[model samples]
Each structure stands twice: as structure tokens, then as C-alpha cells.
Target chain A: MSDLLTIENLKTYFFKKKKVIPAVDGVDLKIKKGETIALVGESGCGKSLTSLSIMRLVPKPGGEIVEGKVNLDGVDLTKLTENEMCKVRGRDVSMIFQEPMTSLNPVLTIGEQLIEVIINHQKVSRPKAREKSIELLKIVGFSRAEEIMKDFPHRLSGGMRQRVMIAIALSCNPKLLIADEPTTALDVTIQAQILELMKGLTKEFDTSILLITHDLGVVSELAERVVVMYGGQVVEEAPIDSILNNPYHPYTDGLIQSVPSLTGEIKELHTIKGNVPSPDQFPKGCRFAPRCHKAFDRCFNEHPDLKAISDSCSVRCFLYEDKQEEEEYNV
Target chain B: MSKVLEKEILEKESAGEPKQEILRVTDLKKYFPIKSGVLQKTVGHIKAVDGISFSINKGETLGIVGESGCGKSTAGRTIIRLEEPTEGKILFKGKDISHMKEKELRKQVRREIQMIFQDPYASLNPRKTLGSTIVEPLNEYNLYGNQKQRLERVGELLETVGLDSSYSNRYPHEFSGGQRQRIGIARTLALDPEVIIADEAVSALDVSIQAQVINLMQRLQEEFELTYMFISHDLSVVRHISDKVAVMYLGKIMEIADKNSLYEEPMHPYTQALLSAVPVPKKHGATQRERITLKGDIPNPANPPKGCVFCTRCPAAMDICREVQPILKTKKENHSVACHLFE
Candidate 1:
């Protein structure tokens, strides 16, 4: 079966002043229908930019899709014109932003926001759209949907606003839902509710999700496949279990260990030594080599491409070069 | 640990009776009055920190974890007198400081308690050098007179926080988030504070950097003999650094206990739900866990429910919870819960 969304060689470049900084350099991603694929990375590692590039919503005047193909169901989204892209945006691909406060219009009523999306994407009357909007709110688990629809963004709490955003995102029942840190701004309990709602709703609609976040915990809970991104490059890609249990890439290993757990007590957390370098100051050889504990002379001088380590696991690191040797020994 | 021992010493001194209470807050309330129209009369109030009471041992780190608008930050601020309490008695070293004069408080206890804000980008003045930011507290407290002594103190503080004194001249913007946070820690330590309130200090940093900051905080707490009221929404971060943890709901503490006890065997239903919700990475396929998805949003503090604040969405809420508010009662040794079910 073909993927719901297939991104190939996608590069998003930021032209700050005059220098062209490649934020998402030579990236590849695939998301099957009803599957949740997580794009995990530290801040400014181009994870968010990759989602933006997929949606063709990169901030203007500075960023542009320098090169890449964003194919949604064999239809190349990159080839579409601005006007044509508008039709595909809410109908084919919808995006739920990180900050619900800013993403939602404070002046407009929740009903108006939901109705606008429904009417724009689908040929529905204003009355029908309003009714559908309430239904969407109810579906998203908002109690007294009619009452909530009358309320403005300021009247609702952060969680409620996020629910409204999800309702709007799912109103058109798009094939793909791109949630960029959907629960980042929410509390744990509220975040759990939202994640559960997203998971349940998407399954019901059989919708594919591109979950982008810095939280590894969310990735484990939501994603079937995990993509570890660093310095705008895919360092590791594997099934969620393989990536979590035995991460092949040093960066992925460091990230998983860094996550504080509740069940097992860790005496010391594995912390990556340095900050994620900006796109402009990206290291020459390996982006993670500066902080990687396993890095040696070869790691600093040569960049390793994503190599298949197992049937379901792939890693970009020199440490996993002799995969067969380790496999044979284990066998 | 040497740090834990240091805290014991500080606790002993602060408690005075060998069982000293470093900080005690009773019926703390901070309501931001919302006024409308030209009259601007005291119409309604946004009960940011409605009413809370907790005590911190002289040397222990007390973690305050709550969602936004849960009043954790406000509780910390009000306890420190950064924001004046509406109605409460903040007993520091067994003395009431809730309504103390600013001048007298500044001289007596202000320097003893310091705060580390959440946002490093906004907490430190961009215009001021890191040296000035660190030294400004010293100047305010009149800790030293000579410029040389002050510079020496600043340098010591920088070293204490694992930052180089050479970067003192550099602006805050020059440093990364983690480095800036270290600077914030250094600044908070300038007054030789006995108690420190870190308000979401590591929340804004990267995951890798968060561990570094948490370790630094743990180390500094011991070195300075500091008692901490660590406020954050992130449970994992709180669990990492805190000896004791308090779960806060809308303007009220839901549960409080030792870190291990609280995480291992949570008594409160809310705490259990919260713990279960946190995702843990597995080796293979996702393992199913009972996730209690709480219904509805947090109720507005201005018009909080008459009963238990958590009763609105609490799965284990009982009939009595709606008619009567539950008073925090001791459930176990050093553990307290405010749920009616426990009662």
C-alpha cells in the first residue's frame, strides 16, 4: 500500500540576512494511513521546520522550500500552486499548531472558527456548518458543545482551546493530521487527555498523524514509527520499540536515557554534553559528534548515512557499521 | 550524600529545637482583583493562589508540581513575599513574615530567601552584564562594600554554578539557555540565601540540558545549605531533584509526600492518574496501561467549586466531595492528602 504522505529529499532553507541556512537538509519521511509517525528532536533541530515544509507553511521573507517533494497519496504537494495548495490544505492535510493561544483567533467565537473551516473545505450551508461544528466539539469531548461554541478563545482554558483546535483540524476529516507539539503547552493531565483524544479520534477516522515533539515520552505513547532528527538530519529511524529498547544511534540513546522515568530509578541520566548547534553553525562531520560520548576520530571526520542495522531498525552512525558482526555474535 | 548532610545541619539551625521548620505558610491567598468599567471597583477576583499551606524543612528540597493556573508559582511568589499574600502567615524560622514591613523584611529575611525564575531569557536583564546581574543582589543586601570583595563574591558564585568568571562581562544573550540558567542560579546564590525557590527553572531548557541543570541545582543546594521550593509542571523534572513532592490543583495542594513514596505509592487519585499518564518507552510494541483521562478542564479559581477542587474531573470523586471540601489530613508518615476518599 502506498503511503498517505511521502517526503523525499525535502530541504527547508532559511535566508537570514543573506546567508542561506538549511534547516531541514536532505530529509526523507513516510507515514502510512492510520499510523502515527513521530519527528523527535531538540529545539531548532528542524523537526518543526520539517512539518512546516510538509504543509508548505514555512514563514515567509526568510524561509522557503529550497528543494524537496511532499507527496500526499501520490499527489506531489510541492507541485501545487498557492491557490491550489489552499484547497489541499484543510481538505487533504490539516495542521494543529503548538501554541493554541496564538493559533486560535481570540476575537472570533469557537463556532465561527469551526464553521469557517467546515464551510471552506466542504460545500455546506452556514446553518449546517454550525451544527457540524458543534458535533465536532462534542466528538472532541467538549461538554455542552453549544455553550462552548458561543465562548471566545479568552473564555476557554488552554486545554479547551487545544480541543477546539483539534476539533477544527478534524472537522474536514483530512487524510493526514500534522500535530506540532500539540500537548507541549498543556499540563500533564490535560496533555494526556488530548493525546488520548487525538489517538482515539484519528483511529476512528483512520487518519494518519505526523506527531512532532521534543518529548520522547509522547513519541513512545503515540508513534508506531520513530524518526530521530538532529542538526536537520535523520540520525535514526526505527519501530518505537526498537528505538526505545536498543537505540542504534548514540544521539537516540542519549535522548532516551535523558528522559526521566517513573518506574525504574536511574542513578544518573545520560545528558548530551552541549546544546544543539544552530543550522548555520552545524558541525562538518556528524552533528552529534561534539556531544556524543561514543564518538571517536572517525566520527569527527566522516558523516555516516542512514544504514539499515536490522529489518525494522536503521541508524546513522559509524558505531553500527559492522551490524552483521554484532548480529552473528548475539545469535 | 554530603549535600543531604549539609541540609540536615541547616535544618537543625533553622528549626532551633533540633526539629526546626524553615518555612511555614498558613492559609496563603493571593487574589488578583478583576475590575471592569470606569468605576474599577473590586468586582471580581482571579484567585491565582486562593489558599495554600505547606512547610519546608530547612535543608530539604520540596517540589511543587502543578499545571498552569494551578497556583504553584503564585504560592512560591507569595511565600517569598515577591507578591503580597491576601490572607496568610508566612512563618520563616518560626517568625511571622506575612505582614512584615518591606524595609524590615529586606534586612531580616529577604536575602535569606531567593528565587530562580522560569524564563532565563526574560529573568536576567539583557542590558546588564552577568557580573552585574549576580552582584546586584549583593549591592541590594549590602553584603559587601569594597568593589574588589563584590567582584570576588561574583567570581565565587560563577564558579559555584560551574560557569567561568571570565564570562561575567558577557551579556545574557551571549549564553545558551543552560548557561543563562546557570547565571540565574549564580545570581540567586549572591545573597547566600538559605532557601531558594526555583520556578520551572529547567522547564525551558532542552532535555539534555535539563539533566545538567537538575544536577547543578542538586549540587548547589548542598553547597549552599539551601532549602528549595522547586516549582514546576514537569513531573519527571520534579522527581529528579526533589526530596519531597507536592501536587497542586487549582490553587490548592492535592497531595504531598516524600518523592519515592509519592511516586511509588501515590495515595491521591489525581496523583495516580497523573503518574499513569506519563509515557514510558518500551523495548518492543507499546504496552497497554490504564490511563485515566480526566474529563473537562480545570475549573476557574475565581469561582471554584464548593467541594473538592478536583471533584469536577476526579474519577474517584465521591458524593461528599461535591458538598464539602476536604481538608488536608495526614495519610501516612510525612504524607498528606486532601481527597475525601482518603477521609
Candidate 2:
């Protein structure tokens, strides 16, 4: 199958006051059909912005998608009208937000919310939509679907609320699902359950998922391909094994080293010193050079392109520039 | 494992004569009455902590692991008397301070059992400097009469947590999440409390910072001869830091055991499912392991399942599990499980 979603040099900017804040600057992404791609980064690194840009739902007032093409099956989503994009949202692509408690409507019943999505996207009556909602709830492993449907969002637990969010996202069975920090607010056990449920449901439906999270464990468990982002740019993209085993970019390396492992005793987790830079004050050369251990004069002076390293791995670092010159590597 | 064995040897020497107990909580319950409708009468209650019992030795970490709304935070808060418990006996050094007057408790037991809150950002007052925040406990308990001594103590405390003393003048916002947590730790240690209840102290921090905080806590626990009630949702962090682990669900203890045993051979089906779901960061694919995907979400704690709270989602749940609530029964030494399977 062709690429489910292809984003090339997508730039999302926020016109705060008068100054422009480039949140997602020149981001490139590709999601294959029935594949799971993880967008890994620290907070404020523009991973969430990329997802928001894909859904054409950048926060109002200041934020807008300024440049780049979001191609879904050869259709440029960025060029579409608001009504046209609305049609594409639930039917062609859907999104699961970060916090389930706030994402879900407090006053509305779970069944009402789920059915509303179905009724809005598809030509279905209320009764038919309600039936579909119940079926979707059951599909997401919510037993006692009838009872849960009647319950309001506040009445359910955190995990249950997240499940409802997933059910709503998957109500129309969109080909692609973009989950942004889906389990960040959840506890580990509940997070595991939700991750398993998402993986199972997505596999069952043969739906592609773009899992955005900072947790490497989740990526290792769920993702087939990994896209590591730093300072609003894709620093590294590779197969899961390659990224985990032999990450090329310094940022990806730092991320891997930082995650506390279950097997061995972690004496000292390697921390990337300094906070993620604000969008307005990005460095001139390598955005990661300020915190990278492998930074040199050359790295500080020049920005590196996303160069292909191997058949399965690509990295945006000066260290891998020789590999591309030696071998003609193509995706 | 060898390091653990060696640590145990060192603990025996450092612990000296085993004191009878440092802190004991019996049938601790914290219920918040929910009022609704036109009348605003007490319609129901949110039983955040419901009838839980545990004890802490003089110098050991007792980890409480549970999902959100499982009452782990409430249990810790109630133990520290931050939120008054509905019912329970908080026996400190054999003295039941449960019914002690607020003034009396604040004078005696409050300083002895300090608590670290979850959000470091909200915990520390923005107006106060790090020095003042840490020194407030010293002033409250009258540990130091002079300002110089208090400043010295604050500096020492900062040094203990691997932070520079120069950060004393910095406000909460000036520091990172890890640095702020260190300041919180320093404040908690100012009273030189016998028992410290760390309620998700490092959960808000990044993974790398979490490790640093955990290491600092372990070191401080050893140095201060402190007993800790470490409450957290991250099982891996809990397992690494805790000597004993208690698994809670719906404001009740599901299982409690030694850290190794709990992870290696979990008895309760909920524990099993929880353990299986934890993504192991090894080369071996987790897919090979049979993950018990609990069918339903956690039941509402306000009105939990009739018999067992876990029965709603438990895979090995039988009719007995649905008919009767299981009590915590000791299956082995230092191990207790609340499930019909054990019976």
C-alpha cells in the first residue's frame, strides 16, 4: 500500500503577539499502512504540534500551519477547506488526545459522545449510531457496555475514560490513528492495559497508528518504526531494533540512556542537561548541539540534513554524513 | 542480587538493635462525603483510603504501588495527618496519635512524620526562596535558634541532595523539576523526621532526573536512619527503591510482599496482569509473554464492586471472588495476599 500519510517540511508557527514562534519547523514524516510509528521527544519538542498539524487542529488565535504539504493518499490536507478537512478528520483519520479527563465531554454520556461522532461522519440514524457506539465500546474491551454508555465521563475511572476516548477515535474505523501522549496521565499498570488494548484493537482492525510519547518502553513494546524528534525536528528515524540498539543521533542516544530499564540496576541515568529551548530562541546550527555530548565546532557551525545511514536507519547528524557518501542508500 | 545481599548485610550492622516499630497504621480510612442535589445532603462518600493496615520498620522503605484513584496518595496524606482520617490508629513508637488534638499532634508527631507532595511546583510557595522553604521546618520545630545555624543546615541539606548551596536564593521557578524536588526533599528532611511519606515525589520528573532523586532518597534514608512510605504509580521505580511492596486497588490492599517475590511470582491475578503489562526493556520481545488484558476498566471507587474491587476486570475471577470480599491473609513470612486464589 502507498504511504498512509506523508508530511514533508511541515512548518507550524504561532504568531504570538507580533513575533512568530516556529513550533514545528520543517518536520518530515511518513506512515505506512498498518504500521506503528512512534514520535519520541521531551515536552515542548513539537511532537504534539506535528500531530495537531496533521489533524489541521492547531490551537486558535496565534497558531497556524504556514508551510508544507500533508499528503494523505495524494490529497493535500493543508490545502483543503475547513468543511473538507472536517470530513477527513473522523472518517479518513482520527486522533486520541493526551488527557482523557479533559478530552471527554463531562456533561454528555459516553454513548452520546461516541454516537455523535458516528452520526456526524457517517449517514447513520441515532439508533444505528447508538448500536455502533456500543459495539465500538465492546471492541475496546469495555464490558458492561450498556451500563458504561449511560454513565457520564466524570463517573468513570481514568483508565475507563481513556478507553472511551479510544472508542470514539476508532468509532469510524479510520485508516490512521494519531495518539498524542495517550498514556502520560495514567499509572503504569493502567498505561500497560491501555497500550495493550490499543495495540490489539489497531492490529485487529489493520489500522496504522502514530504513537507520540516520551516513554521508550512503550515505543519498544508497540512501535515497528521509531521517529525521534528534538527541537521541533526529526533527529533520527529507524526501525525499532536499530534505534534501540545503535541510535546514531546524540539526542536519541541520550533518550535511550535516560530511560530507566527494568532488567539491570541503573546507577545513574544519563540526563540531557539544560531544558528544551523555547521555540523562539532556537540555536543557529544543530538544535541539539547545546546539550549533545558529541558536539564539536563543526556541529555548532552547520546544521545536518536527515541523511540515510542504512537500509532501515536515517539520522540528522554530521557523524553519519560519510555513510551516505560511501553508499547510495534509498528508501 | 549480590549487591542486594551485601546491602542486607550492611543494613543489619547499620540498623543496630531492631526497634519494636517506627510507625504503624491500623484500619486507616479517609472518606470524603459527596453532597449533591438541592438538599446538599450527604448522598455518598469517596472512600479514598478504606481500612488498610501496614507498619514500617525503623529504617526501611515500604513502597505503595497502585494506579490513580487507588488511594495510595490518600493513604500517605492521611498517614501524615495532612488530611484527617475518618478512622484509624496511627501508632508512632507505640503511642496512638490518631485522636490527638491538632495542636498536640503538630507539636509531637507532625515533625516526626513529614510528607513530600507530588507536584514540586505547587508544593513550594513561589514567593519563598529555596533557603526559606527548607528553613521553615527548622523554624517551625525550633531546631535552630540562630539564623546562621539555619542557613548552615539548609546548605548541608542542599548538599545532601546533590544540589549546590548557591541555589538557596533561587525561587521554585528558577530550578528544574529535579532541582525543585531536591528542595522539597531538603524541606522534608529539615525536621529530621523519623518517617517520611513521599507521595509520588519523582513522578513528575523526567526519567533521568527520577533516577537521581531515587538515588538521593536511598542515600538519605541510609544516612538519616529514616523509615519511608514511598507511594508511586511506577512499579519499576518502586521495585528498585522499596524493600517491601504493597499493591493497592480501589482503596484497599490487593497484595503485599518482598520486592523480588512480588515481581517474580505475583499471586493475585491483578498483580500478574500488572506485571505482565510492564514493558520489559530487553531485546526479547514482550509479545512472547501472555499479557492478561483486563477486559474492563477500574470500577468507580465511590461504588466499587460488591465483593472484590478487582473482580470486575480480573481474569481468574470466580464466583467466590464476586460473592465475597477477600481479606488480606498471610500466605508466607512477610507476604500477604488478598485474593480467593490464596485461600
Candidate 3:
């Protein structure tokens, strides 16, 4: 089956003064129908920018999607006009942000906000939209859906607000759902609840999700496939099980090891040596080579392509690159 | 001003290990008042921390884990007297320092207990250099010798936190989040504190950086013989750094036990749900962690449920759970729970 959303060489850049800093440099990803693909990376790794690029919501003036093809449901979003893109955004792809408090309107009641989305996307009356909004609220796991419709966003807890945000996002029933760190601001229990709700909703609607987060635990639990982003590029992409158990990329390994386990005896956490290079200061060759433990001479001078290491795994590391391709490198 | 407390502090001055109980709290409560209308009449209160009791031993890390708005942060802040307690007692070295005056507390107790805030970006003054930030505490406490000695101490502190001494001249903005957290730790350690309360300290950092900070904190704890109240919502982090753990829900502790006991055999339904909810990055694939997705949101602190705070959401809640508050009591060796299930 063709992908619900396909991103090819997506590059989102920030223009500061005369310099252009690549935030989401040359990245490729494909999410099929009903697939939950997580974009895992630390802050400034361009995961958030990539999501913004897909939604065509990159901040104007300085930030822009400099280069990329964001193909959504057989149509390229990049080629769409402003008015055309606006129509496709909520109806084809909706987003859930990290902080629900700021994401939602403070003055408006929950029902007003949800109904607005419903009416804007679907050909429904105010009464029909109201009914649809209430249905969404209940679907997102609210028991007293009618009561919540009357409540303002501020009256609800962080978890409830996030749930409402999810409900609103699902109200349009977009083919693709971009949840960028939707649970980061929430507590673990609340995070679990939100992730479960998201998964359940996706199953019901047959929607694809691009779950962006820095936490691996969240990715492991919620996403089926994981794309490890580092220095504004994908370092590895594989099944969730493969990424957690046998991550090939040094950065992926570092992320996996750095996370202190909760299952058994606690061990001294292993840390990646240095900081993630600032966007402007990204290295000439491999972006992660500066901090990577096993970087050889080749890593400092040449960038490894995002090559397939196995059937279901793709890693961008010189160590896993085919030996037959080594003849093209240093003698 | 209690004679027993005075004697206890004196005894604790020369106190050794095996004589645990570095800090103890008895029936601690903190409530923020809600006011209404013209005259600003008191309209109820937000019971941030309600009648909580716990203890920490010297050189031990007591972790308090909970969801947002559950009062874990409030409890930590209240311990350092950052927020005035509405009621109850906090005994440091057997001294009830909760009611101590600011001036006296600063002299006698404040230095002994320090706090590392969650946002290192917000905690440090952006205008001040890292050197000055670390030295500010020294100046306040009047520690170290002359100007040269103080500057040297600051440099040494910078090196101890794994940052180069040369970076001391740089402002807080010049450092990364992890480095800034280290700077925060250095400032907290400046006064040679006995108990350090870190409230979501590492929650802001990246995974790899968080590890560095956690490892650094663990090493420093050993070197300084520091007792830590590591308050965080991340169970994995708390499990890694803590000797004992307390699971709190809406203004009250549902369970408290040694780290192994708490994680291994969580008795309270709330604790079990909380633990189950945490996405453990272990035994992936088919061996999925059993999850208990609780329904509804946490009740507002001002108007908690009639009986137990968790009764509204607990999966194992019984009829008694809705009518009577459960006291946190020991059920096993060093393991305690506040649930009707055990009874």
C-alpha cells in the first residue's frame, strides 16, 4: 500500500542574518495508513520543525521549508496554495502540541472550539456540529462529555486539556495525526492515558500518526516504528523492538543506554560525551561524529548515507555500510 | 524552641550513621487559600500537601514520585520553607524547624537544606555569570576566606560539576540545559548542605544529558554525604537515584517504601496503577508491561473526594474507599501503603 504521508529530502531551515541553518536537513520518511511512526530526538534535532514542515505551519519571515516534498494522500502539500493548504491542514492532517494549555483557546468553552473545527471541516449545521463535538469528547474518554462541553479549558486539568486537544484533533478525522510531544508536559500516568487514547482513536479511525518526542519510553509504548533523529537528520529507522533492543546507530545506542531502566537493578547511567552541536556549528561530515564514541577517521571526513542494514532497519553509520562500497573511500 | 529539638540538633552535630533519620516530617500540610470578591473573603483552600509524614536518612535519596498537581513539588518546596506550611512539623536532626523564623532558620537550618529547581534556565539569573551564581551562596552564607579564596572555591565548584573552570565567566545563557543544571547543583552545594531537595531537576534535560547529571549527582551525594529528596514524575529516574520512594496522589502519599520494595511489590492500587502506567523500556515485543489506564482526571485539590483522594479513579476501589480516608501504614518490612485493599 502507498504511504498515507511521504516526506522526501525534507529540509526546513532558519535564516538568521545572511546564514541559513538547516534544522531538518535532508530527511526521508513514510507513514502508511494506521501506522504510528515516532520521530525521536532531543530538542533542536529538527523533529518539531519536520512536523511543522509537514503541516506547512513553519514560522514565517525567518523560518521556512527550504526544500522538501511533503506528499500526503497522493497530493503534494508543498505545491498547495495558502488557501488550499488551509483546507487540507485540519481535514487531512491535524496536530496536537506538547502544552495543551497554550494550544487551546483560553476564553472559549471546549464545545465552542471543537464545534468550530467540525463546522469548518464538515458540511454540518451548528446543531449537528454540536452533536459531533460531544461525540468526539466521549470518544476521547470523557465520561461527562456534556458537562465538559460547557467547561472552559482553564477549568480542566492538564490531562483533561490534552484529551480535549486530542478530541479536537480527531474531530476532523484527518488521515494523518501529528502529535509533537503531546505527552511531554503531562505526568507519567496522564501521559499513559493520553497515549492509550491516541492509539485507540487511531485504530478506530484507521489514521496514521507521526509521534514526535524526546523520550524513548513514550516511543516504545506508543509508536510501532521509530525514527531516531540527530543533528537535524535521521540516524536510524527501524521497528520499535529493533530500535530498543538492537539499535545500530551510535546515537541510538547512546539514547538507549542513557535512559536508566526501571525494571531491575540500577546501574550507573552511560552518557554521550558532548553536547548536540548547535545548528550553525554542525560538523562538515557526519553530524553525530563529534559526540559519537566509535567515530573513526572516515566519520570525521565523510558522511554515511542512510543505508539499509537489514530488511526492516535503516541506519546511517559507516560501521554498517556495505564493505563493497568501501573501495570508494580511503585506500 | 523545644528543648528536645535543641538537644537533638546538638546530638546530630556529632551524629554518625546507623543513627539514620537525617530529616523527618510529621503531619505536614500546606494549603493555599482561595479568595473571592470585593472583600476577598476566604473561599476554601487548595490542599497542596495534606497531612503527609515521611523521613530521610543521611546519605540516602528519598524520591517522591507523582503526576502533575499531585503536590510532590509542593512537599519538596515546603520542606525547604520556600512555602510556609499551613500546619505540621518538619524536624531536621530532630529539630522542628518548620516554625523557625527566617533569620534564625537562615543561620541554623537553611544552609543545611538547599533546593535545586526544575528549570535551570529560570532558576539562574540570566544576567549573572556562572562564577557569580555559585559565589552568591558563599557570600550569603559568609563561607570561605578572602576574595582570592572565594574565587578559588567558585572555580573548584565549577570543576566539581564537570564544567571547565574557564566557563565560570560565561553567563547562564552560554551553557546548555544539562550544563546549566550542573551549575544549579554547584550553587546548591556551595553551602555544604546536608539535605538537597531536587524538584524535577533533570526532567528538562535530554536523555543523554540527564544521565550525566544523574551520575554527577550520585557521585556528589557520596562525596558530600548529602541526603537527597529527589522529587520527580519520571519513575525510571526516581528508581535510578532513590534509596527509598514515595508515591503520591492528589496531596497525599499513597505508598512509601524502600526503592526495591516499592517498585517490586507496590501494594497501593494507586502505586500499582502509577507503576503500570509508566512505559518501561524493557522486555519489549510480546512481553508487554501490564497497564492500568485509570479513568477520569485527578480531582481538584480544593474539593477532593469524600473519602480517599484516589477513590474516584482507582480501579480496585471498594465501598469503604469512598467513605473513609485511609491512613498510610506499614504493611511489610519498610513498605507502607494507604489503601483499603490491604485491610
Off by over 4 Å in 1: A324-331, B1-19, B283-288
- lDDT (Cα, tens digit) per residue for candidate 3, span B182-220: 999999888899999999999999999999999999999
Best by TM-score: 3
lDDT of 3 by residue, A1-331 (tens): 5688989999999999999898889999999999999999888898998999998999988998878899998899999999999899889999999999899999999999999999898999999999998998889888899999999998988999999999999888889999999988887778888888887877789999999988888887778899999989999999998888888998999988898877767569999998988899999789999998899999999988998766688889998876425533533
lDDT of each: 0.87, 0.86, 0.89
On TM-score, the stronger of 1 and 2 is 1
Off by over 4 Å in 3: A323-331, B1-19, B282-286
Per-candidate TM-scores read 0.94, 0.89, 0.96
Q: What ranking emerges by DockQ with the best candidate at the front?
A: 3, 1, 2
What DockQ score does model 3 reach against the true complex? 0.69
Worst lDDT run of 10 residues, candidate 1 chain B, spans B279-288
Candidate 3 colliding pairs, count: 0
Pairs in steric clash, model 2: none
lDDT of residue A17 for candidate 3: 97
Question: How many clashes in candidate 2?
Answer: 0
Q: What's the C-alpha lDDT at position B52 in model 1?
A: 81
The alpha-carbon RMSD over the true interface for every model, in angstroms, is 1.5, 2.5, 1.4
